[model samples]
Target: MSATTYALGAFILLAYTLEAITGFGSIVIALSLGALLLPIDQLLPVLVPLNICMTGFLVSRHWRLIDRRLLLGMILPGMAIGTLAGYLLLPYLDEVSLKRGFGVLILWFAGRELWRLQRKAPAREHTPNWVMRLATTAAGICHGLFASGGPLLVFALATTTLDKARLRATLVSVWFSLNSLLTLAFLLDGRLVPALPQVLLYAPLLLVGVWLGERLHRRIDERHFRIAIYALLLITGTLLLVGP
Candidate 1:
């Protein structure tokens, strides 16, 4: 195998491992880190299957813990509308510029998260339905464009609850639902068939990562891990914006 292929597998392993631990980070982390090895277009279509399989495993494992009300009432419609809108807009967009813009946006998001943590801001007792809807919409747009919308979705969910298991389960449920649609779209577009073999090659690594991640989940300090992730995302986003 080529070095790029090897690098891609490593990123997949890391991304899926993080997903297993946190519930919804595979795509975001992969897109951020894989930018160096491949363009966004090549990376996304190939990663779709991995995303679906890993997220499906998570959803099945945590089916009972998902917050169904939040899934149906807030996440579904907003993501549907936003994703559709983004898909419609894709043909007109300049891919390179859009990617660079997204990189900058990601950096800002990571910075804001770090600042929020630094300030030790009090968690809001209640997040309005409209706000949650809006956040989900933004997440859907990110998914439509880059297939990396977990952070926005997580922002919306973080406001709704603090229970880790519920958060992970609910987020997995959302990713599984969205990723299934994306998988179908890829299949319809003829993207999946060509990439299936590559995806299969990485499947074992994805599974192993998930297994290892589940083991680490109990031992790691979530808060510290999250902070470290955000910091890493900031650096990765900056690299994306700067280019090689």
Candidate 2:
């Protein structure tokens, strides 16, 4: 591997570890940083499938903890529509524009979450159902475009009734399903085969990340963890906005 490849591996491990702990950020974190090293188009084929593997493992183990009603009844329909639309539109979009737009969205959500955390504000008493629906659909579009929609989805879900465990499990399940669809899209469009070697090469790093993150997940304080995640997102968003 070249120096850049090694750097990407480090990013992959770090991102997947965070995802194992939180269940929704592997792609966003990895893609944001990795884009600095490689084109997002090349990265997406490898990263999206890798995410399916990581989230699939989490979903299998924690399947019982998922909120099936929310998954099947509310989230999937809107997200499915948005994902298809974004995927179909991707070829016409400018890469730099996509990254900048994504950066702005992440900045908004991360800034808001950090502020709320600082104030020690309580969770919202009621998030209108329509708002949540819109968030999920928008999240799917982001996912389809960049495979990095966790922050938006998380922003919406953080206001819901789910506790930490259920939230993590449910989010992982969502990723597993959405990423699987993305993988299929890549396969049909002839993107997956060329990326297969890179995917296999980095697979072991994901295992290491999952092990470490699972251990840390049990020991870390939730509040501190959120601070760390949001802080990272804030940095990532800024980098995406300013990076060449």
Candidate with the greatest lDDT versus the true structure: 2
Report the Cα lDDT for residue 89, model 2. 83
What's model 2's lDDT at 20? Answer: 91
Q: In candidate 2, where is summed lDDT lowest over 10 consecutive residues? A: 155-164
- lDDT of candidate model 2 versus the reference: 0.88
| Predicted candidate 2 versus true structure: per-residue lDDT over 120-162, tens digit per residue | 8887767788998998899889888988778888877776788
Q: Backbone clashes per model, in order? A: 0, 0
- Report the lDDT of model 1 for residue 39: 75
Write candidate 1's Cα lDDT for 1-244 as tens digits.
9998998888889888989998887888888888866877777778877888888887888789888887898898899788777666766777577668668767877887788787888875677888888889998998888787887887787767548888888887877888788778878887888888888899899779878888888799877887888898899888888885
Cα shift from native, residue 105, model 2 (Å)? 2.2
Model 1, clash count? 0
Clashing pairs for predicted structure model 2, backbone only: none
- In terms of TM-score, how similar is model 2 to the real structure? 0.95
lDDT accuracy of residue 199 in candidate 1 = 87
